[model samples]
Structures are given as C-alpha cells and as structure tokens.
Target: MKIWVLRHGQAAAQAATDAERPLTAAGQQEVRLMASLLQGQPLDAILASPYLRAQQTAALVCTELGYERGVATAPWLTPDDDPCEVLRYLAERQERNLLLVSHQPLVSQLLSMLCEGHRGAHVPMPTAALACVDTDFVAAGLGSLVLHRTPADLSA
Candidate 1:
C-alpha cells in the first residue's frame, strides 16, 4: 500500500480557536499547487484531521482530483493524537492508495514511526508538504519513502 500524507497549509495563529483557524491567501495558492502536482494520482481514500486547515487543504486536493468533497476525519491525525495507532490502522487496511491531510509534527512523527519506528528522527513537515510511504500490511520497517514534496517545490 502507498500512503500520501500532506501537512495542512499555513494558517493564522491568533484565531479564537484552533478549529476556526483558516488558511491564508498564500496557503490557498499552495494548496492549488500541491493539488496540481497530485492531480494524476489514483487515490483510493481521502482522510484528514478535523481541523479547519487540514479540511481546507484536503478540499483543494479533492477538487483537483475530481474526488468528492467529504473526507474521513481520523482523530489519530489530529495535533494531539498519537500517530502509531493511525499507522497501525492504515497498515491493516491494505488499501492501494490513501491520502491523509494533517498537521505538522504529527505528519513527521507518523512518517518516522513507519520508516524508523521512532519519532523526531526526520525533519519537521512544513505547511503543505507531502510524504509518500510505500509498505506492506502487518509489516514493520517495510516503508520506503517514494517522495517528499513541499508546495514551493511544486510551484517551482
């Protein structure tokens, strides 16, 4: 299975609540570029953190890929959630392709956990950055990174 994890675009920090935070104009453009880069991929499922930023970013990708607007909100992708559970869940699903839109630290942590079985071993995931991991079900240390991209890289 191949899993694509995308960090949410830049969002304002001073929002009344984290859930209410929205993406900035540049963030929107970043999403567009990221979406364009992923337009040709055949994503079997779309998952996202329930936060506004992640939801917004997922929406852009879905729009570009002609997927439905709704995304499955996985609590494990949330900022405060543990990534190992999510990894285990995905590993068991055996889906061919899955897209997950989430926040930093968590995205990076998840990648590290899958590839290295440890957290904080990889660089932090920047806004709108993506990491593609390929692995087999019920296997540990089987993940290999296929791609790691940022919005800026896509724009360039």
Candidate 2:
C-alpha cells in the first residue's frame, strides 16, 4: 500500500482560532503545484483535518487530480493528535492508496513513526510538503519513504 501524507499549505498568520486559519494566496499556489505531483497516481481516498486550511488544500488537490470522491474530515488528524491512533486507524483501512492532508507536528511525527518505526526521527515537513510511504501494511517501521518533497523542491 502507498500512503501519501501532505502537510497543509501555508496559512494566514492569525485567525480567530487555530482551526479557523485559512490558506493565504501563496498557500493556494503551493498546494496547486504540490498537487500536480500526484496527477496520475492512484489515490483511493483523501482524508484531511477539519481545519479550514487543510480543507482548502484538499480541495485544490481534488481540483488538480480531478478526484471525484470528496475529502473526509478526520478529527484525529489535528496537529496534536497521536500518531499511534492514526497508525491503528490506517491498519484497518481497505484502500490500497490513500492521501492524508493534515497539519504539522502530527505530519512529521507520523512520518517518523512510519519510517523509523518510532517517533524520534524528524522528517522535515514544511507547508505543502509531501511524503510518500510504501508499506506492506500500516505499521510503525514497516514502511519505506519512497518520496519526500517540498514546495521549494518542486519549484526548483
């Protein structure tokens, strides 16, 4: 199975609440460029945080990929959520390929847990950064980081 993890694009500096933060214009552009990378890839479902920025990012990806299935909002994808919970949930999913649009800390920690089998390793996930893990099953240490790219990398 291939799991694609994407951190939401850059957001406005301030908002009424953290979850209310919206993507800036630059964020939308970044998301669009990042989404192009997955144009021909098989993505069974898109799961994203309920945060406005994440939702916007997911929408841009859908527009780029022409993905018909709407994004599913997952509360567990919040920035502070536990990576273990995410791992456990993914293990039971039937999809062969999945895209997760979420925030930082959770994104980085999840990648570390998946790639290193533990949470200590730091995988850099800037805004709109993306990592692709190929795993036989969804478990810590069982996956390989086949691809990791950021907006700067893409632009370059």
- Score each candidate by Cα lDDT: 0.81, 0.95
RMSD of candidate 2 to true structure, Å: 0.6
Per-residue lDDT tens digits for candidate 2, residues 51-151, read 99999999999999899999999889999999999999999999999999999899999999998999899899999999999999899999999999999
| Candidate number achieving the greatest lDDT relative to the actual structure | 2
* Residues forming the 10-long window of minimal summed lDDT in candidate 2: 33-42
Q: Tell me, what's the RMSD of every candidate?
A: 1.6, 0.6
lDDT of candidate 1 over 1-156, digit per residue (tens): 888989988898869898779999888888887777677787888999889889899888888778974688877788867777776778667569899998877888888877777776775578988888887753446688888988777667
Worst 10 residues of 1 by lDDT: 133-142
